[model samples]
Target chain A: MKYLRLVLRSFLRSKRRTVLTILSITVSVALIAILQSILATLNAFANNPDASNRIVVRHKVSITNLLPTRYADWLRQQPEVESVMGLQWFQGVYIDRSNFFPNFASEAEFVNTVFKEEIVEYSDAQFREFLRDRNGALVGKNLADKYGWKLGDVVSLKSELFPITVRLTIRCIFRSKRPADELALHFNYKLLEEGVSYMKGRVGTFFVRVHRADDVPKLIERIDRHFHDAVEPTYSETENAFQLEFLKMMGNYSAIIQMITGAVLVAILIVTANTMAMAIRERTTEISVLRAIGFRTSQILAMLMGEGILLSVLGGAGGLAIAWLLAGAVRGYVGTFLPYLQNFHIDAGTMSLCFHATLAVGTLSTFIPAYRAARRPIVDGLRSL
Target chain B: MSGEPIIRLRGLAKSYYRESLEIPVLQGIDLEIPAGGYYALMGPSGSGKTTLLNLIAGIDRPTGGELEVCGHTLNGLDDDELAAWRSTYVGFIFQNYNLVPVLTAFENVELPLLLTPMSRRARREKVEEALAHVGLTEWMEHYPRQLSGGQEQRVAVARAIVGDPELLVADEPTGALDHKNAEEIMALMEGLNRDLGKTIVMVTHDPKAAHHARHQIHLEKGVLDRTIEVNR
Candidate 1:
């Protein structure tokens, strides 16, 4: 603390260079924070604790392959199964191709029961009204709020996968634990079946809710075994695993993000190291004078290291602030295309990582140069003047 | 000047090594300066006068022989120990003033005191007193760049005396100053020696500056040539 003023004065000696170094670190840290937050959001979906008791049943070939809707009946008959629902990705565009969201055709009777953790809240009367009306649709609160949709508003969607346009009336607006889940719209599967002839008894997936969390593994094994000899073999996994499968389709995104973050860190380290090296080199004479005046080599090293760390921490803080302010806009933009990132925000873990990363950069970058400056022969330094 | 000498050197030697070759700067020179004595080392360029001063100040160690300054055997102490000893017993003033450009005059003067266990208020009072002694009290807040060459050297003098070290070693303290500034600096050193009884050793090429000292030691080819008791 006694040397803080000296360090601060030396740091501000070159205002332009210091500010530039800080800005470089700030921009790099912000990029790392945003990228890491994206990875965190995806990981959260694949590790959700709420998905423990639920299982998903899909065709053995691929998720794109449809299964017989009668699979839900067999799933429901199992002693471990509490409820089941058939869900299909509609791949529909509302108004035009620009407005995109996950719209699904689902069996309304067991949706709230099978996905109780996701469908956190909804009106019972509104759900009954949705069941009574053939063209009724259930919109998530975020989706409804985004489009300024209300009860009785008619929404028309043209399907890209099938030759049909289904006009739906908004009946129930439900809330979910995750903002990503709340950016979807669901309607009765019967509507799609009535619109297209071949889609009558097929669904993309069947969601099964087990009576207990421990029953999920056994039930998944039994269901896959029961359909092994049938015309369409089944693959069953817990809901968390199903979400991870979707993420897996993106191909090792975690490694890619980590690589990019690493590259950015290395680049910033080089930049910061170069700046500190130059600063120390410029003060060689001053350093020697201090040494000659009875200041210890360790004291000189401490003051220089303090300056470097202070610069990096300042940049790290600025970057975190930038990431925080832009989080909402990032969520809104990315939610349009990637459903998993709709709730994307910089969590405490990511902030801590960035802060620690900057400290490491500061220490590693300044160590060699500061040590060299401190250990240089005092006579050589004095002679340089 | 009674009692034992403040500085004792017995055949002190220093050399520079360039890879496989050796270049000797000081060789088998012995000298001593009594306590409270104002002495000047006068020689031509590269005569090893500054090297001798540096050795006496404990900033550099001799490659051979014994060196004792301020009653401490400098030859036996390591680099860190030498630094600590210098802080307690020796102060330095360089040819270029060597004030840290980033620090104000006050900060530069306070640099030596920061290494001590002195309180902030005590250090401040000492620094102010030193600067006032140098007639630079009003320029305390100004940076080195803001001060004149003479004023900067005065600040350097303040810094050298602020810690109240027993010995002051100056290597051409007026080498960068004009005639008027050099005279002012010489007068200040003379006053420090006569009034406060500081043991002063200065290396200089200026005859007028050397005349300010009570004794003059001349060096040639890295060895002491003669000693003269000044009539001043």
Candidate 2:
């Protein structure tokens, strides 16, 4: 502890160099922290704790392939299935492509039952009004606020994939338990069925709530087997697995992101090592003087290592703070493109990972240079200057 | 005090090797200084005066012969052991004063004592006493940069004696000082030797500085040339 001041003073011997080195580390650590946070958020989506009792049934051919709407009746007949809702994705643009949000058409009755977890608050009269009007719609609080929408406001969207435009009056605005769940709009599926001839008897997917979580695997196999010979075969899996399949559509980019993170850390290590090497080389004579004054080699090495670790940790901590602050802004930006990132944040787990990474970088960068400097003969070091 | 020599060198030798070239710096040197003796080593450049002083201080090892100081055989001691020996028995003063620039006078003077098992309060007391002896007690909080060259050297002197080591080895302690500061440092060193009973071994090229010692030994080309007794 007494040597801490000496180590710090020596580190600040070149104030500009130290500050610059710390900034470099801060930038890299921030980048790394953000990347790791994104991966964690994606993983959380894939393994959502709330989705354990739910399963999704889609066409076996592909997600783009549609399944018969009557399949929900067959799923509900199974003892394992408790409730079922038919969901069809409607790819429509509001004013521009940049103002994107998830818009889906699902059964209006199931909105207040099967998806009770998502709706934090909504009055019974507002939902009855939605059912009473054929062109009525329900919007999430986040989506409504983004467009300054309120009850009775008419929301219109032009379909890019279809030859029709949707105009509906907003009758319900609901808050969600999760931030990401609040960036969506759901309208009655009957509107799409009555308007479009192609979607009259089909739905994009079927969301089923199972009676028990432990029976999910067996129920998935049973449902898939029952429709094996059907004209439009069905595929069944847990809701978490279905979300993971969507995530997997981007391919196995997790490995690529990890590789990029590794490359960034290596670059940071080199920069830090070079800075530390130069700092130690310039102090050769001073180190020799310390040796002459009864400082042993271990003491000298410890001092240098201490200084290096301090610099790296400071930079890392600063970077983490920056990452934490930028999380919400980045999520808002990404929410425009990927709706699931609306809840982006640096969780406690990622913070711990980054803290450990900072210490590791510190140790790796300084060990070789500090050891070399400490091991040099005292006479040679004294004569260096 | 015992009449036996505190420092003894028997046929001491040191050499440097650059690839295949061998350069001898000191050869066939035999020397002894009794307890509380004040001696100055005088020679030309490359005459091995500093090299011999380093050998006696246990900072450097003899190449071919036995060397002993403060009753410890230095030839077989490893680097760590030598460092421990120096901490216990020897104190060093360099021409550059060599106080750490970042540390204040009190901290610099307290450095050698850090090697011991002394408590912080004990170390502080020792540092204050040493600084008082050097008449720099009031300047304890000043850094080396804030002090004059003479004051810096005095702080260095305080650092050297703070641990109360048995021998003081100074390599041209006043070489970088002005004439007035040099005389003042010599007077202070003379008082340390005469009053505190410290065995002093100094290496210098200035005759004025060498005259302050009780005896002067001259070397030429890595060999002893002559010894003179000073009367003052």
Pairs of colliding residues, candidate 2: none
lDDT of each: 0.92, 0.89
What DockQ does each prediction reach against the true complex? 0.82, 0.60
Deviation (Å) of B93 in candidate 2: 0.7
Q: What lDDT tens digits, residue by residue, belong to model 1 across residues B16-38?
A: 89998998999998888899998
Tens digits of per-residue lDDT, candidate 1, A51-72, equal: 8998999999998888999888
Model 1: lDDT equals: 0.92
For candidate 1 chain A, the 10 contiguous residues with the lowest summed lDDT are A332-341
lDDT of 1 at B149: 97
Among incorrect, acceptable, medium and high, the docking class of model 1 is high
TM-score of candidate 1 on Cα atoms, chains taken together: 0.98
